[model samples]
Target: MVDFTPVPALCGGLLIGAGASLLLLGIGRIAGVCGIVGSLLDAPRSPDAGWRTAFIVGLAFSGLVGFALAPASVTNVANSPPALVGAGLLVGYGARLANGCTSGHAVCGIGRGSTRSIVATCTFMLTAGVTVFLVRHVVGR
Candidate 1:
């Protein structure tokens, strides 16, 4: 069974919301991580590279901080490194196809009342639910 910690979840949600809001308010850019990383890869010397690098670096730093604060909470459920890498690649591809990641659609787009983002976010959630159900129940993983 999964351990659900409401406090940590709430805190994480708040932090994410705040970060997204700050990015939009401060730089007038959506906090879509995939787009940021893609932009960096496509144009390393672009004018916006500084903020993109900082945002990506901040994400990595935050993960390190989380692991340092609660080592037990940083556990990886995936046992195979290849599987994890494949999953990451698939997610990146999906985000590129969808034009935005969950953060950009669900948080920032929904906040701005975007119809396309709303539909995309719903589709994302539905797909995720079905995938999890199939993997855990049908596949007995």
Candidate 2:
């Protein structure tokens, strides 16, 4: 069984909130990772794109820093690497097709009192739950 501690979860939530707040205050941008990554790939149009690129780069490096500094703090799940990579790609494609990711739709969108976002988030949750059930129980993974 996987054990999850609330302390780290709360800290992660705090950091996410801080990042979103800073993005909103400092750059007048939403701290959506998908949007940030997409904007960074294009030729610079908005003057704010530079900072967005930096923020995205820093976010990427933070994962490396966490693993390096606290290797034992992380858990590794046993799975086929190819299967995981394919699943990740499919999820990314789905998120892009859906116009936003869980962070954008669930966190920032719902926070702004958007009815569409609320519906989207609920749909996302339902679909995720169904998929997990099918994969774990129905498929006997």
Candidate 3:
């Protein structure tokens, strides 16, 4: 019943893991998007702001390059601008509340064997399942 394409998924996971490993090994930093972007926005004059800015811009540029390289890989998921904006706001709020996003908890923190990250990762999975259930069944969407 799994609807996912495992090869692509695995490849993406490996890339993410490699990226995280490189960040950790090279600069002793966690490759958490929320934290990186947050630090850039919250403290533009911080000593590490240059790196953070470069990281964020590199992310955006990578996406743009990917889209240009494979337009088929970029499918519109039927989301409006406002809906996307609201989702971004919610994600930012959640990141602040949890002190990190899924990448930080599931990848870096869990890799470090942090108890808090494990719990947060589990919570993220549970919440995702519940949201899907409600969306597909309860809300009839």
Candidate 4:
């Protein structure tokens, strides 16, 4: 069973929202990880690449800090390297197809009252729920 840690979860959510809001307010960019990474990869020499690179670096740095602060909270359920790679690829594809990730659609876009983002976020949640149900119940994983 999943451990219920409301305080930590709430803190994390607040941090994410703050970060997203800061990015939007500071540079007028949505805090979408996939879009940032993709744009950086596509045009490393672009003028906006600096912020994108910093954003990616900040993400990595925050993960490291989180691990350092609470090593026990980190969990790695995917033991297989190939499985991890496949999952990453699938997620990238899905994000590209959807034109945004959860952070973009559910957080920043929804905050901006975007109708398309609302629909996309709903689809994302529904798909995630169905996938989890299939994996845990149907596949007995």
Q: Which candidate has the top score in TM-score?
A: 4
Candidate 3 regions with alpha-carbon error over 4 angstroms? 1-3
Per-residue CA lDDT of candidate 2, range 1-141, in tens?
888799989998888888788888986877767766666665467787789778878887987898899988667878799979987887777666666677777878877777877887898899889988998999976
Q: Judged by TM-score relative to the true structure, which candidate is superior, 2 or 3?
A: 3
TM-score of each candidate structure, all chains considered together:
0.91, 0.83, 0.91, 0.92
lDDT of 3 by residue, 1-53 (tens): 96779999899999999988988998999998899988788899999998888
Candidate 1, poorest ten consecutive residues by summed lDDT:
70-79
lDDT of 4 by residue, 10-96 (tens): 998999999998998998899988889878888999999999999999999988998999998688896489978988898898887
lDDT over C-alpha atoms for residue 140 of model 1:
83
**Superior by TM-score: candidate 1 or candidate 2:** 1
Candidate 4 off by > 4 Å: none
RMSD of 2: 2.3
What residue pairs clash in candidate 2, if any at all?
A: none
lDDT of candidate 4?
0.89
Candidate with the larger TM-score of 1 and 4: 4
| Per-candidate alpha-carbon RMSD to the true structure | 1.6, 2.3, 1.7, 1.5
lDDT of 1 by residue, 1-141 (tens): 988799988998998999998998998999998889988998999999999999999999988998999898677685589978888998999988888988888888898999999999999999999988998899985
